[model samples]
Target: DPMVMAMLVDKMQEACQHLDRLQVRISDTRSSVLVTGDLNAGKSTFVNAILNREVVPDDQQPCTALFCEVKSVDQNDGVEEVHAIRDPEAYRRDDPTTFERLSLAHLRTVVEDNEPGYEMLKIYCRDAHGKSDSLLHNGALDISLIDSPGLNIDSMKTMALFAQQEEIDVIVFVVNAENHFTLSGREFLRTAGKEKAYLFIVVNRFDQIRRKDRCKRDVLDQIRDISPRTYAEAEHLVHFVSARKTLLNGLARSPSPMARGAMLEPASEADLADFKHLERCLRQFILEKRARSKLAPAHVYLSHLLSDLRVLLAYNAQRSARALQRLDGQRSQNEARALQLAKLRETVLDRLDDTIADTAQRVADDAERHLNRFLDHLHHIPYDVTYHGMMYLWRYADDLYRAITMRMNGLAAHIQTEAIRLSSAASSVSTVVAPPSSVSSSATTLAHRDTLGAGNVPALPELLDRAALARMARGLLPGLGALAVGLVGYARSLVAPMGAGAAASHALVTAAKRPNPLARGAFGTLAFAGTLMLFYVVADFRRPLEQQLCRAVGTHLRRTGWVRRHADATGRRAARALRQGLWRFQSDFARIQAEEAVLATQWSRERDACQQRGQRITAMTTRVAEITEQLEAINLDT
Candidate 1:
């Protein structure tokens, strides 16, 4: 696309260059008349006859290889000077950078030498005609004549280039009366006709052509075929003259290709009269018909320039329009994508919140239900805890409490781990909650981030409190409450203490046969009380102790809400870890959305720029169209 744009710029530059040259040409009222013909067809002679000076040299060989422009000295501040222009487009009469100043005396040598590099030569000289005698003296317009190289097969293209210049108001196609129109002459006329269709056709050396009528007819016939429009106005546009006679009466005599003779008395006056008439007609054509002569060439060139520029501008406009369209589409798409990403991140985070809360509730409920069931099952499992007599029953109670604590702790751990996996599964639909892109493989990335690391995953909250353990251990003995009073009373009033103590008490009673009854009763009661205290210290009520310990543990766990509290803690901890990951995802997602928004802004600007470019292209195209329309109107009016 850049290459295409560059190419368009280059073409526009060329158009601008052409406009520059046109500005220079139309800047003044001076009209340029080009005298071009076949090789040595007296083109230089005709130019001299017009200026009435031989400043432009004529040679047997191709002398005027380059364009030799002749200007009156009065136009150059009344000074005679010559300039050789190397680059005509940049040529300025006073600018040293543009042209090389030459000696006026060497005008003949400069014109005849035909320098290799220079394409244009300017000659400023004093013409032979005085103020009222010449059109150059007219205040209305300034006129200059250019003598071009003789038309040849090799130089035809170059001559064509010169003749079609924007300032060339008139074309003088001088034909040698003896030879008529040569192939080169015909070809030049045919091509030049496209712009300057009406040319001043001059048949020079007419006096030497004895068969003048046939020569005139033959030239007119060639004119009709080359330019019918010019031939139709032959009386005004065509002429037959003796440039040699005019020349003999004009500049210095120099040996040339054409043979020279003494002035003959017979046709001298006729030749002079005809040459004079040609001069008069040329002046009238330049002054009276200045509009067609001056403006037509420029109009022709301007029309073509506008046509080319129109094509170029129209092409650029279409491309700009399409570019604007594409930019709009891309900008819109980026904006929509940014919006979508924003919404998706919010939705994912919301779902994660619900999942975490729901998981905590489920974990709490499962822990409460499963733990209570285990305690209930313990009521029917008496054979498992071996009752090693009522003496070691208290040891057995300690063992039972330890066993329940370990089982509950293990179950709480299992509940925590199960909560992690199920919570992860519940929120699996939200992939954005995954890790912070640190996982090496996709397989583990989701599972890894949704749950905590292995070290933290299966950890249970503290489940078994010391208070519950102490309560269960104390269950193997009687309470220090009113239950202790009832046990001692039952031992004192209802049961014998021990068989040895009873036999000892009987022997003592037999020895002191009729001692005091109060004393005897008191002794027997003290022995019984002592025995009861020792027996109660090591009671072996295994079945009742086991049930009581299990009941206390279950009661402690429920009353304190121990299992549910720990399970909820575990679930909430896992949720916080997952929520943190989701927060990271939200940050990353928002960053991406922000970047996309920036891109969309840039695209929108570019789209606006393209639209403005299309508008500019349209403006340029319109200007060109207006210029073309004006030229057409002028041509029609002319």
Candidate 2:
């Protein structure tokens, strides 16, 4: 983006600097006039008439092959000089000098040699009285008159040479009135007329026309038809002139007629008037054309600079829009990731909860079964008999304790496993939710339970002291009493309980008194076993032992509860971590959104500036067009 900004600034500066330089150059430029025509079109005669000297040769055959530059000299002595400039190689080969001074009378003879080295002919002439006083008489600025080769022989080459010159203020296209507009002449007009130059189409040799008025009208019509762009609606651009007549009149008025035989007939006033009108038109057009030419380059430079500015503005706007689009797309992605992380947190926590519930339930069921078996074994041991019975109960209690511990450990392991899984899930989600810099690699390490098997598991029997254990044992005494009462009622119902209570008591005593030996033995054994069971059930050893088993089972349940609690804690921690990560991501997204807002504001400002510049360019372009139109609409008026 900075690069783009730099490029935009550079382009703007470049265009502006170029326009400034062009304006400066245009301000100091000099105006020039190029005179061109077909072969034998009196172009040379026209130039000679303007200079009041035969600087350019007017012969039967084509004489001038190179461009001739006619400049006014500040020689009050009236001594005109003709200087010939030769090409370097040609001058080196034939003559050592690049410049050759020629006599004014022999200027045509030397230039007509058509030497290969001839580059240009410079004629420094002092204007004769009343001769050079017309048309090209600007006060200070010296307007050089350029005469080029005939367009018919090498029109492309000739036009190419003329096109190289700068600031062409006026173009005097001399065409023979007898031939009007030739194909080559009209083509040259089309090519040269497109330049920012005031065109004056002079029909030379007007004396050749038989019917002057009719021929003049026909010639003007022909000029309009042939070169409509040069003559269309600007009838003043077309002028009928007799350069030969004007030259003859100048010679006749000369102190010594240089060409005595050239003036066989005196020049008519009408012919003189035609020359004067042509001169006046040239003067008016040249003055205005020079003034407009000064502003032409400024107009062109503004147009070019405006065009470049518009293109640069469009490019910058497109780049800014693309950048904004990319930012918006990234913001959307961040938001989506945040939402996904949130969902993952919910899912992981729910799954951990389910795992904890299932595991806790299984461990609880196992502990309950172990406690039931221990209690049932205690019911079978006789209390009034041997010490071995007590030993057996203690041994069973120890086994139950071990079993409960193992189960609790297993439950802890399960919870740990679930915690690890939840942590892993959270870690995976973190990769997507948080940026790389914010993601913690050790986030899931809390799930590693290195202390579970190293005696850190909560022991069942150790949870309560002797007093607490004795209190819990006393708390179970009511349930034990109820069980003993129920057992006595079951024994009575099995013996006799169908009749009344007194009758059942009498029957039971009679059966005991008349017992046979085998019946006696069997009844005695049965009574002994029942009495032992009853005594054992009511012994203090059974109570204490039952309390021990209850403590072990309670301890196991507490341990499993710890596991569940750990699992819950782990789940909550992981969920909280995920939420925190998600929050960070959201925070980052918010920051990005804020940055985007700032960038958007900047983009809006740049767009406004671009729009304003575009509007200015449009206005300036319209102004340039108006100025161009005004320049084109300029004529001999203002």
Candidate 3:
């Protein structure tokens, strides 16, 4: 949208270029005077008076619709010609009277008929006898008198034709003295008054007023009251002149008396003097005030153009600034969101790792406590060296294995609980990190499991097998060692008592009255040696058997290591699943960040373009201001 506006501004710049060229041509032409007023205001009659000839028709009905240009030419033959030059170049030529001549009577017929085909009529004349030398004397600039159509009736059509003409140097507003400043006349004055042109308000037919001085004073006062700005002062702006008297006086001054009497009207010396003064004022304005007249129109056009351009440029700059500001705000919001997501990603990952580690540690500690309790129960059982004792030990080992298996399953459930928590966390945070469409059902569905009972908890694969339980049972060896020590102590207590009884019976049976001391001493020494040997054998077998029991216990309990391995495997699996979900979230977040980066870059480029456009507008505004200042500084009065 702004691009289209930029194109419009460019077109305006081009239009200004054309205006500059038109202004140059305007400055080169003779100062033009456009005569305007309401119907029967004596506008055409006033033009005829100024030219000192009855060229423009003046009648009761409307006559002139097209503009008429009258210029003085150097013609010794005293011939006058009128041409309807539609071509614009004709106005530039000194002698544009080369076209077909239309009689004054035929021109009157065309005006009365109201023919719209003709654009303008050019009349070329010269003073062969130099009768009106004071008016168009030497050193006086050539003047073009343009008579416009009547106002208030068919005003639009009339004004449309007037707009087609070039710069108007002066406006001669002719008002009938009898009516003075009609509604239509005031409206026309207000419209034309704004132009930078010399305005002259003439109260035509002053001779008709019964009290000339009073009527003229009242008319001047009324004009000032209506529009004071139309002229510098009442005296300078108002003129009282009878067009009939002025025309008749000029005719009387003709070289041939017969020609003068034929056209002259009856007029008093006072009417003649008033006409003379009006003529002198007009002549001075056309000559002495020439510079002001030419520059005024140009000054007005440039000033207005510059002012409009300044307003348009200011509006464009403000619009551009507002657009850039909105873009910047959006970019900031996007950046903040991206940062928030990044931080969330880090926090979620950290929490997930901590949860997994804590779950694993709890499972390991639980398995160890269960194994220790099973070993304590096994240690207190009676030792039978027979097959029955061995069967009992195997049964105890099997029961312990079942308990470890159940504990490992509980650990698996705990791990699943933690995994579900992680999945729900990922699901909830996924909505924040990415769109809902990106989340997989598997990851999100886990959160719904919270509403279900324990029976609804999905079954997990076995964590501990027989081999794993056996590994866990290895830690029960110290209890088995204590069992071996008890067996050794029982055997020592029974054997020590029996050995003493048999040795005492053997001594009684083998004893002689007074007994051979050496023989008896040898028997007693041998019996004592046998008893010490038995004790030594039992003591020596105790440590070896205890070591054997420890080995057996270690072999059975080693199966429990399978449970630890299963827990580790389950933890790895869960961690992997959680990691996969986290990775998906991370991937989505990364893409979001990338998209934000592109958007930020796009906004930055647009902002830069707006800034450049603003700079250009500022530069153009400065140039326009400088041109306005130069136009204002020109001394048109001098």
Top model by lDDT, which number? 1
Candidate 3 per-residue lDDT over residues 1-638, each given as its tens digit = 89987998797886677477557746554566778877778888788777766777767576777667765653213456667656545544445453455765577776666454666777666533254453333434556677878775576755763453345667778888888787767766666655554467788877778888788777767666656655554555568878876666666766633335555457777777777677667666666666656666566666777888889889988988888788878878877887886687676654756744554455444444443444444444344333333336445444443433344344444545554554445446667756642223343232222322222222211223355445544434444444455455444433322236777766654542234555445545555555555455443443333333434443444554533543454445444555566566667777877887887788788888988988998899899889888888987767
Identify the runs in model 2 with alpha carbons over 4 angstroms from their true place.
Answer: 1-32, 51-53, 73-77, 86-100, 114-118, 126-144, 152-165, 176-197, 205-235, 241-276, 283-442, 445-638
Model 3 backbone overlap count: 18
Ranking of predictions according to TM-score: 3, 1, 2
- The pairs that clash in candidate 2 are none
Which candidate ranks first by TM-score, i.e. highest?
Answer: 3
Alpha-carbon shift of residue 511 in model 3 (angstroms): 54
Model 2 lDDT tens row, 1-638: 89987987887786667556555645654456778888878778788787666567777678777777676664213447766776523533134276777667777766677554667776767545343363334454555677878877675656665554334556778888787777777676666544333467888888878887887788777766665645563556778878887876876756544557678777799888878877776765655555544454444445455455556556655665665566567667656755665575566434644533444344344334433443345434333323235447555555554554454444444544444444344434335434532323244223323433325444544644586557645644555555555556545544533566887879877865654455444545555555665456545464555456555545554556544454445445445544555456556655655675676577566656656665665666566567656645644333
Worst 10 residues of 3 by lDDT: 452-461
| Candidates in descending lDDT order | 1, 3, 2
lDDT of 1 by residue, 474-589 (tens): 64343343345544554454433344676777866664564455644554565555556545644645555666666666665557665455555555655665565455566766
In order, the Cα lDDT scores of the candidates are: 0.67, 0.59, 0.60
Candidate 3 Cα misplacement greater than 4 A, ranges: 1-18, 74-79, 85-99, 114-117, 127-140, 152-156, 211-228, 253-266, 320-417, 424-573
